[model samples]
Target: MGKLRWNILGIRGNPLATRPGMVKIQEKNVMLRKCWKTLLIGILFTLTLLIAGCWDRKEIENRGYVLGVGIDHVVSSGPKGLYDLDKTPQAAGQRKYKLTIEMPKFNKQEASKEVNKGQNHLIWSGEGESMFAITRMISTKTYFSPFFEDIQILVFSEAVAREGVGDILDFFLRDAEMRRLTRVFVTPGRAEDILKAKLQVEEVNSTFIGKLTANTDKAPYFAGKAELGQIAQALRSNHSFIVPIIVTEDKEVRLLKGAIFNKDHKMVGEMNELEILGGKILRQTLKQGIVVAPNPADPQHTVAFEIYEKKMNIDTSVQDDQILFTVKVILIGNLGENMVHEQDAVDPVFTKAVEKEIAAEVTRSIKAAFSKQQQLKADVTELGDLVHRQHPDYWKNVQDRWDEEVFPMAQLNVDVKIQIRRPVITH
Candidate 1:
C-alpha cells in the first residue's frame, strides 16, 4: 500500500522538492502535534479537579452530637431572684438555669475496633442566666461544636416548669438546627435525674426515653403523643396547654400523669392515670383500650370490647344566655372477651346492650373529667376555645367572665354510639 502524503495547502507544487513549502509543512505538523498534546493535558487536568476534595467535610468522630438537654433553676447567692454584677460579669442581676447537655462520645479508633465502646455517651453541663446563654457557654467550653440536631429528648425541671416554660422553649424553637419533633418531658423533681437515669434496656438513654414517649399511644391512660411542635403551638394558642408528665419510680422513668396548665405557662394542676385517660377520651385522642361492660342479667359476668376506632365531635349551643356543650363520640370495635351467658354472638339484643354500656362508660368518663376541671378551675381541654369558636357572639358577651361565671356554669352532655365489628373469635 502507498502512504498518503499530507496536503497543508493546494499550492499545486511539490513540497518535498521546494525548500520553503517543505519548511511550512514541517512547521504545521509540529503545531498540530503540540495542539493535540495541549488538549490531552487540559482533559487530564479537568478530571483531576473533578475528583472529590476535603471542603468543609467533618468526620463523625469529630462531631459532638447532643442527645438530651436538662434545664434547672440555679440559686445564686447574689440577690433575690437576681444575679450580682460583680460576681458574674456576663449579665447583671439576672437569675438563670443550670443546663446539662448529654452527647455520645465516639473514639474513632476504638469505635472502629469495638462497637460497644462507641455506644458509650457522655454529658456536659453549664450554668447561665438563660437557657440560650448556658448553651453558648457550653460551646465556649467544648472545643467541638455542639450539634442539637440529634437531640431526642428535652427534660425540664419541676421548678423551671412551674416558674414558666415559655422562655426556656423560646430558645429551642428559634434555633435553626433544633428539631420540632423532639420529645419534651417534665421531670417529677429534677430534670437531671431523668437525664442521668441509667438505660436498663436500650443502649442510649435518649433512645429509651424516645421509645417511652412513642409507646404511650398504646397505653390506656396516655393520650396523644407530645412533640416539640405541638407544645409550641399550644403555648401560642388561645386555650391552655397540657404536657405529658414523667416520674421516676424505682429508678425507672414512667409516664404517670399529665401536667395541666392554665392561661399562664405554669402548671396549675395534674391528672392521675384515670383522670388522664378520661381527659384523653374527651379530647378524642384515645387510640386503643378495653372497656368493661357488666352484664345486666348476670352481675358477675362482664363483656370486654377492644376499642379499634373512635371519633369525637363537640358542638356548643347558647340557650337562655347559657352555653351548653354537647359531645358525641362514636366508637367501632370488636368484642375481645365475653363472659356473659349468651350463645348468640351477633344477636341484636346483645348489640343494643353493648351500645348502652358504651354510652354509659363515655358519659361517666366525660363527667369525671368535667368534675375535675370544675374542681381545679383549670381549662385543660380548651373547652372555652370550642365555645368561642362555635358561638363567637356569645363569647364576646362573656369573654371577661368566661373563666369565672360562664365556664363554671357551662354544662356538658355526652352521647356515645358503639358498633361491634366482630366477636373475639369466629364461632
Candidate 2:
C-alpha cells in the first residue's frame, strides 16, 4: 500500500510476478502435443506393416482335397494272423488295415478356373499298423497338405468289417478335420477295389459312388443310408449297425446287399433287398416301397401301389421266461397301376382287398427276416436292447447267454396297416 506496483505493459498488475512458472507450463503443453503426433504416426506404421504380410494365407492350389477314404485288411502270415505277442490281438493286428486316400490331380490352372477340366482323380495308398502311421507316411510323400474336410464317403473292406470296425474308426473320430457327415459303406470284396474302380459315366470313382448311394432312395428296398455319425452311434449303442454293401458286376458298381454288425463290430451277416426292407422296419427307419397286390378275379394280373410314407414302431415285453416282440408298421400310399384286364372304371371294393394283400406282404417279409436271424444267430433287430431295457433284472441273469439262448427263442408279432390316399386317374 505504501508503493503501488504496476506491470511493465501498464495495463494491470505485475506480469513478472510468476514469469518462470508460466514459461514452464507453456513448454510442457508444447512437448505433450508433439508426443501425441509421434504416437499416432507409430500406430499407423504398425497397421500398414501387418497388411503386407501373408503368414496365415493358404492357397487352394497348395491343398490336396480328399474326397473318399478306403480301408482294407492285409493278410499276413502268422499263427495268430496279424497278431503280436506284446499287444492285445485286436490292437496287434491293427497294422493289417491299409488306408487309401482319393484325391483329384492338382492343376493350378484348373483349380483357378470356374470349371474343372482334364484333371483325373488319383488314389494314394499307405500301409501302417494304424491309421496314424498311414497318415504320417502320406504327409511325408506329398508336398501339399492333405485335407479331409471334403471327404464325402468312406469304404471298408469286407475283411476289415468282418474282423471289427472299432479300430478302423478310431482315427477318423479323433481327427479334427474329418467330417462327421461322411457316408460309410462296406465293399463286397477289397475296399481298394471300390476306390480304384474306373467309372464310365463320372470323372472320378468317388463321386460316382457318392451319387449311387445318395440316389438309393429311388430303389424299392433300400432304407435310410448309413452316415459316419449314424454308424458311430449304432456301434456304441446296444443295437447293431448296418451299412450298404456294394459289389462290382459286369464292370459296374451295384448295391449287392447290406452288411449287419453286432455290438462287437463284427459283420455277423448280410441282407438282400427284401431282407433289408424287413430289417429297416425293425430298425424303425423304413420310408417307402412299392406293394404289388395280385388280382383275386383275374389271378394272372396284379395291381401296384406306390408307398409315399411309412412309420414303424417296435415294442418288446418279457413274460415269465419267454420274450415277446411286437412290430407296428403304418403305410400311406397311392394306387399307381392296374395291370388287370385294362379296366377304365375304378372300383373301391377291389382297393380294400389290395390293402389287405399289402399288409400280408409286409408280414411275410418280416417273418423271412426272423428266419434269417435264426440261421445266422445274429440279433440284427436290436432285440437284445429291448430285452435289457424292459427287464434289466432278467437281462442280468442271461447276459452271458443272451445271444445264444434268449435271442434264438425270441417270438415276433407283426401288424401292418395300409391306407390308400389317392386313386389312379384314367385318361
Candidate 3:
C-alpha cells in the first residue's frame, strides 16, 4: 500500500509583499498551528473512544437470571414476633424477611435430567431486615451472581405481608435492573414453601406459579395478576389493594384465593374466591366467575353459569351523615354445567329462573365480601376511592376513619343482573 501524504502548501504568507524573513516566520507559525490542531483532534478522538466504555454490558453466562423471589418473615431465634438483637442476630422472633430466589440453569438442567432427573432450577434464601440486604446476602450462598433483570415473580408470605410490603417494594422499584412487570403473590403458610414446592407439570416451582398466573383469561376475576409496579403505585397512593394467594400442598403449588392489604399497606385478611367476586364486580374486572345457583326446577340439583361478560356501576352518596354505597353488577354468561335434572338448559322459562337464581347467588356473594371487608376494616373494593373521586369533601371529612368507622357502618346495596344462554347458542 502506498503511503498517503497530506500537502499543506501555504505561499509563505505572500513573501513578495512583506519581508522574506517575516513571511517565513508567519508560515512557520501557521504550520505549527495546523500541526497542533491535528494532534489535538487525534487525542480527542482517542479520549472519546476511551470514555465510551460499556458500563452496563454483562456476559450472559455471568448473569444468574432470577426467575422468582420469595420473601418470608423470619422469627428471630428468640420470642414469638420479638427478638433481642443483643443476644444474636439469628434470634427466633426478630423482624426479618427471608428472601429466596429461583434461578434456572439450562445446561445444568439438561445434565440433571440425565443424572438425578429432578429439578433444573436452584432456590436459595437469606435473611435480612430489607429485601435489598437479603438479595445481596444471597450471593454468599451461591457461586453465580444473583441477577434481577429477568425476575418474573415475587412471593410474599402471609407473615411478611402482614408486616407490610412497602419497604420491600421500595427496593424493587428503586432497582434499575428489576423488571416492573414481575408478578407478586402472597402465600398462606410460607413463601419459601411455595418456592420450594415440587411442581409436577413444570420442573421449577416458580415456572409453574408464573404459568398459573398467566392464565388470567380462565378466571380474570379471581386469578388476577398484579405487577410489582402496580402494587407500588397503590402503596404510593395509600390505597388498599389485593394480591393473589398461592398455597402449597403435597409437593404441589397452586394459586388460590387472594390476600387483602389495608390502607396502611399491611395484609389485614384474605378473600375466598367468592369474596374476590365482589372485588371484581366493584372493580369491573369480573370477567369470569362461576356462579352455582340452586336449580330452579329441582331444589336438589344445581346449575353453574360461567360469567363471560360483567359490568359494574358504583353509585356513592352521603345521606344524613351516612355513607351509602350501591353496587350494580350486570353479568352475561352461558350455562356451563347444568346438573339440574328436573330443569332443561334449553328451556327459556327454566333459563330465566336460573338467571334470577344465579343473580341472587352473585348478589349474596358480593354482600358477603362486603361484610368481610367490613370485618377486616379494609376498603379493597376501592369504594373509598370512588367516594373520594365523587365527593372529595365527604372523603376528606371521613378520610381518617373511613375504614374503621364509616366503611363498616356504611350501607351497601347490591343489585345483580344476569343473562344466560344455552351452550350451543351464540350471543
Candidate 4:
C-alpha cells in the first residue's frame, strides 16, 4: 500500500520509462519521418516522367538508309550532260556539282505478293553549289528522311576528282551522320552512271562495288579499299593518295585502275592494273597475283608463278640532299602454270631457276610502278611517311616539296625474293 522508492536522478524502478515532454518529441519525430517519405515519393514520381522514353528516337521504317553517293561536275547545259538551272547568280565559268544517292526500296508486301522482282534499290539525284546544300535539297524529294549512317560507297566523276575532292568531301567529313569507313571510288565517266549500272551478282550496285574493292587480296588489279577517313587524313596532311577507278559498259560496271592524286587532292593520273599489282606488293603486300617470266629452257614460252603470301619493308635515307629508298620484298607462293615443257618440278635446280625468274619478274613490275610514280610526281605509295619516320630532320627540309619535287627525284631500289612451295604442274 506504499509508493515505490526513486533514485536521486528522478528515475523510477523502470529505468527505461519516458519522462514528461518526451511524448510530444516522439510524436514530432514520427511526423517528420512521414513528411520526408512523402517528399521522396513525389520526387521519384516526377523523375519517372522525365525519363519515360527516348525523346529523339526515330522509327527504323521511316528512315531512308542511304547506301551510296556519287558526285559529278556539271560541265555543259546543252544536249550532253544537260543541267537545268532556272537562274544563276554566279559568274560564267563557275561550276556546279550534281549529287546522286542510292537507297533501298522498302518491300512491304509478302513474298508471294512481291511485284518489282529483283529491284531493291532506288537512285535519287540533285544539284547544288555545295554537297551539304545538295543533300538538303534531296531530302525534300524523299518521303522518308535520308539517313547517311549506313552509306557504303562514294563515287566521284573524273572531272570532279580532277577539280579536287577536298571541297566535296568537306561535308562528308563534318557531318555527324556520315561514317568515316565509307569506301571511295573514281569513275572516268559520269559517276551517276556507275550507280545506275545493272549488276548480276548483287541487288544493289553500290554494295557490289564496295565488295569488289575488298577483293584486292585476290585480284592484284584492284586498287584496294580507299576509305573516306583515309582520304580525309591524306588531304589534311597534304599527302598524295589514290582512289579506285571504275568503268561502266553495256550496263555493267568494272573496277579497273587507281586514280592517283597529288598533295593538293587533285587527280593527277592513274595507275594501270599491272602497276597496281606491283605497288601493292612493294608498298603494302599482295596476297595473290600472277608473275609471268620468260622460261629459261624455252625462250618463246612463259612461266606463271602465283603469289600467295608477301611481306615488304621500305627504308629511306638522305645523303647530300638526295633521298634513296630501299624496298625489300619476300613473296611465297605456288607454281600456277609452266609453259616450258622441258623443266621438271621434282628437280631442285628447276625450282630454283623458277624462283629466280619469278623474283626478276617481281622486280621489274615494281620498278615499272616506281617509274610511273616518278613520272606523275605523285607519291601514292606513302614514301614521304617513310622519310618522315626514318629521317625526320631531312624530311622537314623537303616536306613541302616531297610530293612535287623530292619524291620524283628520289631513287628507289626494289629487292625481291620468291619461293615456290607447291608446284601444281610440271612441264
Candidate 5:
C-alpha cells in the first residue's frame, strides 16, 4: 500500500507478481474444469454403448428353416382328413387345405456328412382354410420361428391341382418371406409322401429335389423347371403353364411327367416323357439329352446320339384367323453310344443314316406333344404367348379364345435336322 505499484487491474502492487492464495484458486479452477470434461466424455461413452446393438436380431438356431411345403386338399372330415381340429376355431368348410412343412434336421455333426433315409428332415402337418392360420398354427407346435425365406419347393397333389392351385398359391405369391425361385411341382400321389420319402443323395429331400430341376440341361424329358415366380407371372398374365409332375415309387422320387394347365387355371392334362421332350424342343429349351434311334445296320440295337447343341426356329402366320406354326429344329450332337458293333459311327454314310433316324424321332416327339396339347385344348407350350409377342394386334383379337378355340385347331409343321459331330472313344 505504501509503494502503491499499480497492477493491470489498478488495485494492487506488482503487476507481474501472483499471490499464493490466487495460485491456489487458479489450480482449483483448472482441476474442476478437467473433472467436468472427463465427466462429459464418460457420459457420451455410456450413451454410445447403450444404443449400439441390434434390438431384433435373431440367431440362426432360433429360426425354423421351412425347406419345403406340401399342400393337399381335405377330401373328407374323417380320421385322415386334415387333423383333429376340434380344438381350433375353424369355420365350417373353411378347413380346406392340408399344409405340410419340412425342416432340415440340424445336427452340426451329421450336417457335414449325408444322413441316410428321412433322417435329414422333420415334417409337421396342419390343416386350415387360411394359409396364414395354418402357418401360425405351426408356430405353436415348434419352439423356433417358422421362416419361409429359405423354402426350396412347394408340392401340390394332383387332386389339388385339378381343383385349382390358385387358392393355395395365393398365400405364397403374396407372402414377403416366400422366394420367387422356389420350385413348384404336382404329384399324382400324396404331397406329404414326397416329403416323407427316404433319400440317398443329400441330407435334405427338399434341397435334393430342388437341385433336380437343374438337371433339365441334361435330361430332355424334363418340362423345364416351373418356379413359383414364373407361375405367379403366368397366373397374372392369364397364361397357361406347365407344372412338372413328381412321382414316387418304392421311395424313389422321379420328375418324368408334366401337368398342363389351361387358361382356366386348372390342371387339364399331363405330358409323358416323350411328349415333354418334344415340348422342350418346341420351346427351344432342349439343352442336352440322349436321342436313341434304331440302327439301320441292326434293327435290334439302337444308336444313341447325345444332343449337345440345338437350335429351333418358329415361323408363325395367321391366315383367315387360323394360326399356323412352322418349327424348324436343328440338332447338333455326338454319337454317345453305338449298340450295333458292326456299324462304324465314323463312316459318313452311317452317320447320315443315324442322323436321319434321329431327325425322325425328334419329329415324332414334336408331333406327339403338339397333338396332345391340341387335343387337350391346352396352350401350355406358350403358343399363345408367341402370338402375343410376334403378332400383338392379331393376338388382341383372339386372346380370349386362343387356348380353347384357336390353339386347338392350329396346325404345326415340324422340320428336324440332326448332325453328329463325334463318337465316344469306346466301340
Candidate 6:
C-alpha cells in the first residue's frame, strides 16, 4: 500500500500507533479516567455503609413509653424515698421542678402464682432545675429509656404554673418526640397526685383522664380542652389563655373551672365555676350544660334548661382610644326538668317567661366573668384576638400593652337571649 508509510524514530510502520492486542498512550489515558470514576463510586458506597443515621434508635421491646407527665413545684423537702411518685426535693428559696413520668407495665403471660397482681404502672420521677436536665437524670435511677411519643396528658401544679411555665415548655417544644395533642391541666394540689391517684373504672390513669376530657359533655361548661398546641401558641404569642383545672379529692380526679394565664405566661387569677361557664358562653363553646333557675311562673318550683347550641357575636371597637366590646350570646336549649308541668311546654306565654329567666342567669354569669377579667387585667375572653383580626392597624398599636394596660380599662357590654326549642321529660 504505497510502499508502507513509515515515520521518524520508528523501526517499522506505525510504531506509535495502537495495535489490535496492545494499548496506545491515548487508550491508557481513557482507561485511567474510567478507573478513577469507578474508584470514586466504590468509595462512596463504602462510606454510605459506615454512616448510619439515628444512632439513638432503640427496639420497641426495650422502650418504656411515657403515658402521662406531671410537674409540680416543691413546697418543702419531702421524705426521701425510692421510687416515690409524690415525694420531691426542694430548695430553701429557689424554685425547683418535680417531674413524674408514668409508664404502664405490661402483664407477663406466665403460669407462676408469684406474679404481682396489683399496680399496673411504674412511676418514675426526678427533681432538677430544668425539665431537660431532669429527663436525662431520670435514666440514672430507672432501667428503661423514657420515650415520650405516647404521652397523652401533662399536668402542672398551681405552684409551678404560677411561677410561669415558659422555662418548662422550652424543652417540650424543642423535642421532636413531644406530642402536640397532649391535653394540659393545672392542679390545685401536687400534680403528681393526679398521676398517682387510683382509678375506679379504667385501669390506666392516663386513659381515664384522656377519656374524661374527651367526653367533656359530662360537664361541658366548666371543662375545657386545652391541647398543648394551643398552650404553646399562646405562650409564644405572649397572649392570655385558659387551662382546665384538675383537683384531687381522695384519689379521685375531678376537672373544675379554668385557670387563667396572663401575658407573663403565669397564672394571675382563676375563674370560678359560674365565670368559667360564662366564659365558655362568650366563646360560644358551651355545648352541653344545665342552667338551673327558679320557675318563672312559680317562684317556689324549680326549672332546668339543657343547652344544645350557642351562638355568640363579639362586636369590638376603639372609641376615644378606649377598647369597647359587646358580646351578644344566643342559646338554644330544651326544658329538661319542670316541677310545674301544668304549664304547657308549647305555650308561648310560658316559654317566653322561661326564656326571660334563663337570659337573666346568662347575664349574671357574663357580668361575673367580666368582673374577674377586670380584676386579673387579662383578656382570656379573646377580646384582643378579635381586635387583631378585624382591626389590624388598631391592634398593632395596642397589642403589646393590651393585657396590662388597655384591656383592664376597656368597656364591656353583655346581652343574652335564650330560646327553648323542645321540652323533654326525665323520669
As for candidate 4, its clashing pairs are none
* Tens-digit lDDT string for candidate 1 (64-133): 8889888888755644545534534576436577888877657645433433432356778877766777
Root-mean-square deviation (CA) per prediction: 6.7, 7.5, 6.3, 5.8, 6.5, 7.2
Off by over 4 Å in 1: 1-54, 75-90, 93-95, 107-119, 292-303, 338-358, 396-405
| Per-residue lDDT of candidate 4, residues 1-427 (tens digit) | 1333343233445343366565556578779999999999999999998889888777776788999999987656675345655643433334488899988766644322432343557789877677777777778887786789999999999998999888778999999999999999999999888887665543577777777776677777678889999998998898888889989876567788999998888999999887887788666757676777887667598888888787788888788899988889988888888887667766888888889987887788788788888899888888788788988898889998887788789898889898888975544
| lDDT-best of 4 and 5 | 5
lDDT of each: 0.74, 0.74, 0.78, 0.81, 0.85, 0.80
TM-score order of candidates, best first? 5, 4, 3, 6, 2, 1
Candidate 2 TM-score, true structure as reference: 0.76
- Model 6 regions more than 4 Å off: 1-59, 78-95, 108-118, 297-301, 341-346, 424-427
Residue ranges of candidate 2 with Cα displaced over 4 Å = 1-56, 75-95, 108-119, 217-220, 250-252, 293-302, 341-345, 383-404
Models 1 onward score TM values of 0.75, 0.76, 0.79, 0.82, 0.84, 0.78
Model 6 per-residue lDDT tens digits across residues 124-214? 9987677877887788777787888988899999988999988788898888999999889998888888888765543567767866687
Task: Report the alpha-carbon TM-score of model 3 versus the true structure.
Answer: 0.79
Compared with the true structure, model 6 gives a TM-score of: 0.78
Q: Which stretches of candidate 3 lie over 4 Å from their true place?
A: 1-56, 75-95, 108-117, 220-223, 423-427
Best by TM-score: 5
Question: Which candidate number would show the highest lDDT if scored against the true structure?
Answer: 5
lDDT of 6: 0.80
- Model 2, position 182: C-alpha lDDT score: 87
**With candidate 3 superimposed using the best TM-score fit, by how many Å does residue 91's alpha carbon deviate from the native?**
15
Q: How well does candidate 1 match the true structure in TM-score terms?
A: 0.75
Q: Model 4 scores what on Cα lDDT?
A: 0.81
Write candidate 3's Cα lDDT for 1-427 as tens digits: 1222111233434434276766686678889999999999999999998999988877776678888988887755645454534522642334467788888766764746642333567778887676776777677676678888878889988887898888778888998999888889998787877766665654566766777776665664464887888888888777788899888776566768889899888999888877777667777676675777788778788888888777789998899889888888888888887775545567777778888898888887788888888899988877888888999987889988888889999898888898875544355
User: Residue 130 in candidate 3 has what lDDT?
Assistant: 67
Higher-scoring candidate on TM-score, 2 or 6: 6
